[model samples]
Target: MSGNQGSFSLFQEILADQTQEINDLRQYITNQEQQLNTMKERLMRIRIAVLMNESVLRPFFRVPPRQRDPSYYPVIDMDLEAIEWMQANNIGGQQNAIRRFEAIYGMNLRKCKILVRTAPEEIVEAMNQRAELHYSPCYRRSLRDNSKIKRMKLICSEIIKLWEDCQSAAYPSDQIMVKRSNLERLLNEFWDGQGKKTEWFGKRKVNLSGNKVV
Candidate 1:
């Protein structure tokens, strides 16, 4: 009887030790996961900062005329130039113009289509005038810079708000993740809409003509 009791006591000690070790391992894994998430958040912030800086600085770094390559033409807010090119070449109809713009600029077909469809009539008229007067590349560069800076600032502010909301919400991890995914999708849609609006105003010759869109 005495030997049996001793054996049972020894087994309980072993089981207790195993349970504590398992808990310790779980704690270690949780700590590692938290650290990994922190690192990822930091990396995302850094990437956004780099992109914003690039957008701001890009207009200043004009390629020398001799070194300029057709493939390196700036991609953002070139709708006015594209339309002028289309008109000059006798490209008829908005759809045809959009397709030609996509092919010439190597831009996404959907984005090209959106910009063409959404451009205000006033802006198109201004582009026509600019084309007639032979606007300088400097004018185009200024337009692109302003559009890019405005979009970047808007996106950055929205993303900051999203982060703040996520951090302040008292939600479980899974719920927070779902919210983040949804926010990202909404952000992309907002970006697309903003691009179209920016193209509308950015391509407008109003700054030079001193006219405002009604």
Candidate 2:
């Protein structure tokens, strides 16, 4: 009976040790997640500040393209001079234009349009820099491993759409608070699921009839 009690005590000690270890691991994971969230929030604040001050930063950093190089493509025809130059130098039609631009910039037409329209000069400089970055074999090899870029772009686009929708929604002033809250909830839920619950290129059905539930 003493031996049986001794065995039981040993088992309890071992179980206690394992439980303590598990608790320690959980604490470590929680700390890491907290650190990541803090970093993300800091980065987001910096991003917003930079965006707010982009116009001021542009003069020093962005030299607008005075001439359209043959390698370049204009996402929009807003600038008549740029459009005329692009047309004069364009060897092929619309598809070729988009293909050549994507080949150099590593982004699609829609993304190009978004950036260019928002900050034409800066985007032009960025595309030129990105093109140069890809010139080296080492850089090219590294870029091939960058799977997150497209996923980030898709998520950003969706978030932007939600924000824009919230802005444009015809909600009354009293209901604006509720509308914004709903938009935030939708943004968080969908953004969290992106690349985890759903693949970047996964097909989703859309209700074009404007009858779908929100």
Candidate 3:
């Protein structure tokens, strides 16, 4: 009977020791969870601070407002093709063509002249495609986001959509022209309807006269 009692007491002690160990483990786990949460909060605060600093510093780092490409100015020889097209379409002179091209594609006078003078049909086509995509409605209206990388990705996606539209068209030239009109319409609507909200994209301002990438 005494041996039985001793065994029972030993077992009770073992069980108590295990329960205490478990309680200690639970307490350690709770402290670790609290520490992890605190670290996460600190990380979030650091992220917010970094973003705030970027927002404050962005204007200073912005690319200076676009200027005309120096080499292409003066437009020495008139682009015969542009002149011919203008005559056919009753569009008038070189100045008028420049204005029309700028209004439609946001191209500068010199760039338009260069496009008109480009010898290779394929090169001209490629240039037009690039301009159309860069000035697409979706691109112009794109807003800034928290991630600059994601913002660039979104812009590229919009440009791809423009490319797809051009590729899928029955007549790529006509589709490109239509897209140009759409670009003008969308830009006008953004500027007129949204007030300064359109400036957030900065592309319109950055590429005001030509193809300078911001």
Which candidate gets the maximum lDDT versus the true structure? 3
Error of 2 at 58 (Å): 9.6
lDDT of 2 by residue, 13-110 (tens): 99999999999999999999999978655543332222223333233222322321222221232222232334565623435444544654566667
- Each prediction's whole-model lDDT (CA): 0.43, 0.42, 0.44
The Cα error of candidate 3 at residue 10, in Å, is 1.0
Q: Give the per-residue lDDT of model 1 (tens digit) for 29-71.
A: 9999999978655543332232223343243335433343322
The 10 consecutive residues of candidate 2 with the worst lDDT sum are 205-214
TM-score of each: 0.28, 0.31, 0.29
Worst 10 residues of 1 by lDDT: 200-209
**Candidate 3 residue-wise lDDT, 1-214, digit = tens:** 9999999999999999999999999999999999997865554333223222324223432433244222211121222343444456564344654554455334465555654564234334434444434433333434642243233333433433455455454435444445444444444444343335544344442222244343
Model 1 alpha-carbon miss at residue 131, Å: 31
Which one wins on TM-score? 2
Candidate 1 backbone collisions, by pair: none
